[model samples]
Target: MNARIAPPATVALQPDAIIRHARAVIATEAEAIGALEPRIGTDFVEACRLILNCHGRVVVTGMGKSGHVARKIAATLASTGTPSFYVHPGEASHGDLGMIMPQDIVLALSYSGETDEVLFILPTLKREGIPLIAITGKPGSSLARQADVHLDGSISCEACPLGLAPTTSTTAALVLGDALAIALLEARGFTSDDFARSHPAGSLGRRLLLRISDVMHTGDDVPRVAPDVGLTTALVEMTRKHLGMTAVVDADDRLLGVFTDGDLRRALDDVGVDLRGATVTELMTRGPKTIGPDKLAAEAAQLMEKHQIHALLVVDADQRVVGALNIHDLLRARVV
Candidate 1:
């Protein structure tokens, strides 16, 4: 017969006590992080200098909770122009140590500075002449002593009520990791465009890298008509293109003005105006706001917002209408 396991007992939920404890945890973690600011001194500068001069990747390794923080640090470093990757210390003993090269730098994290798995790989790294940077709460521990540069991530206590879990300590280590990544990013003169390249699938990438030419309606897709075209004909082009606006161009395709739905509305409001006999130039806004095809789509969005207009004509150096885009196009491209 199969044995039945008894369900665990449940404690009564206490809203007031729960909220108080949560706030205490936040205060503890925040204090621990705040303490780290003044500690950023010579050691932190040396760490950044080593990483900036590293010819190979920053191989981050740790055990347990420290390993989790190590992974995040590696990712942050990789995305912020610092080439880095996380290596499991335990796996390093099982031939994964081959992943570490002589030219690379090893960044090890351990709160106690005595994590066996991380310590187990220290000799190998040393034998290969690879530099080590250690972050540990215990300054005198073996890991810290062996490191070429040691970063102290010490905290007075963990935020955990039982004081056994990695709480405030991990927060300190993570924040330290972030500081390192950002400092290196600034040192390298990494720009938003550089960051966007590393994150091409994200919204930030689209905003920074996407150009007006990449999303604009080009060639025949652009709704363009002669300045002499009647308002009715211009309306037909606008409706067909579904851009809510049409560009009025001369015989040489030079943009002269733009006729939008707002213009059409005002024309209808004018009792003296005759839509049947009105030419596009008569109703169009002359010298409409324009953007270059090579400009960022985000810049175009900014221009539209600043001018309180919904559409813009993409012009060339010679003022020729090469493309067009409206607010809807920006939305479709997810650039707005």
Candidate 2:
């Protein structure tokens, strides 16, 4: 008869044990980040200086989990005024190293400072004479020794219960990368407008880059009535344009006043005003709030909120009505 082996016994974790483990992980990671503050000295400063002066892109490379961090760091750098991109260390050996130019600087991540894939490309980096910045746990490791600048991303212990998986170490690396990017961003004097150029598809970019002219209704869509026209004609124009308001203009289309639905109601409630005889200029809100088409759509929204109105008449330098946009237009454009 064949001998049979029994399976190892399993211990189901209690709820308290699970909670305690979670707290331990959080505490360990927090302490690891806390440790980084004191270590942020010349090496971190030099990394920022090198990137700030770099004429070409910052080429980031690493292996495994560090590789993931490398990609994110590259993305952050690229988006925040520093030109950067991630190249897998393994791929670098297989002809991708050509992507690195003599003007570019290489940032290599290897927590242990001895990741083989990263090590494999070190000779190529040296051959090309590209400046190297290394992030590693071991200061004496080959990767750190070869670098022109070394950033210590060491951690006392992993958040993992086994103490083998990268948890605290990865967090430190990621945060260090962020520190570098933000420092460069500040040094470059990167503005919201500059950031918007890199991220035109994002909400913050839209808020910064989207001009009123881009979202406003122009041509025949704009609700306009001559100042001499009666409130009845202005009402018909407002209804036809479906904008709840109409701009009263002169013969030259210069904005005279704005007559909204609210003005119509007040006119009717007046004791002596006749809708058929009263002109738009008499019933309209003169010197009404106006915005230029070149202004940001966000500014338009702010004006609507502050004045308790839904629409704005877009004018030119001469205050001639050229376009109109209500909250509905902003909503349609997702700019509200």
Candidate 3:
């Protein structure tokens, strides 16, 4: 016995041991993804083409843990430009079979490809002439053999010593599903703008859908001055608006130029400039950075960054002043 008493033994470590085991399983599964690059063939491309031509939402189904992975894959597809949803195979045998239509394609996931819950629904799908795609280890299994397309989700071995849990197989299935979604995205020329439409409330959507018009200061809040206004008057308007710059516009509010503190400093540096008496027409910069209200705030930020501008004027298609915004507007809007 040591000077200090030892702590009591407990079962908490048994669960922790499983965590280490899961990490190794995940690493092994990642290796499987790297290996898939070379193994991918014409079948994979053909599968992608089929998915692209699909007129209906993807219907994903599986049993047990495979069902869990299937649900996530369905979600990933739905969010990334392809429309999809998950169905439990057990439920599909019930009234859920009504969810399937001939136009919709079914994606079934199973390690052995012999899951009873999944296999039970196969006959009806077949009789209905619904095209089927399968992900499994054994291509000879009933589900795999019946599918119109078969993707190899096999792994060298399970990370589990008993080789019982669906660890490696599930990860491989997930990776394969991601591969299919990404391939289809590229094949269809799916863009971030399109993806944003599906996720309108997310960060991506905010970046795309929230345009300069959505967050810019318009009407009285925008600092405006006639092209003939003195630099002194323009400076007062800039400070009043607190947007750091003022637009110099014509009688019709068509843009003439822009004036900012930067231009004021440059004017001050000029050998013969008189800030108090000089007209804004003489001090204002010609053709300063401006943007259309239709453009994305993200695009506006990019333009501001490229031009080293602290603020920008938002104009309509006719180039008439419509609004004003600054870099801080992007931050306040949380679109940055």
* Candidate No. with top lDDT: 1
Location of the lowest summed lDDT over 10 successive residues in candidate 2: 226-235
Model 3 spans > 4 angstroms off: 1-27, 262-278, 316-319
lDDT of each: 0.95, 0.93, 0.88
The weakest ten consecutive residues by lDDT in model 1 span 327-336
Model 3, span 233-293: residue lDDT tens: 9989999999988999999999999898988889989979887778999988888888988
Tell me which of candidates 1 and 3 scores higher on TM-score. Answer: 1
Model 2: CA > 4 A from native: 1-16
* Arranged by TM-score, best first: 1, 2, 3
- Please state every model's RMSD to the true fold in angstroms: 1.4, 3.6, 5.2
lDDT of 2 by residue, 123-197 (tens): 888998889999999999999999999999999999998998999999999999999999999999999999999
The deviation in Å at residue 153 for candidate 3 is 1.2
Specify the poorest-scoring 10-residue window by lDDT in model 3.
31-40
Q: Which has the higher lDDT value, candidate number 1 or candidate number 3?
A: 1
| lDDT comparing candidate 2 with the true structure | 0.93
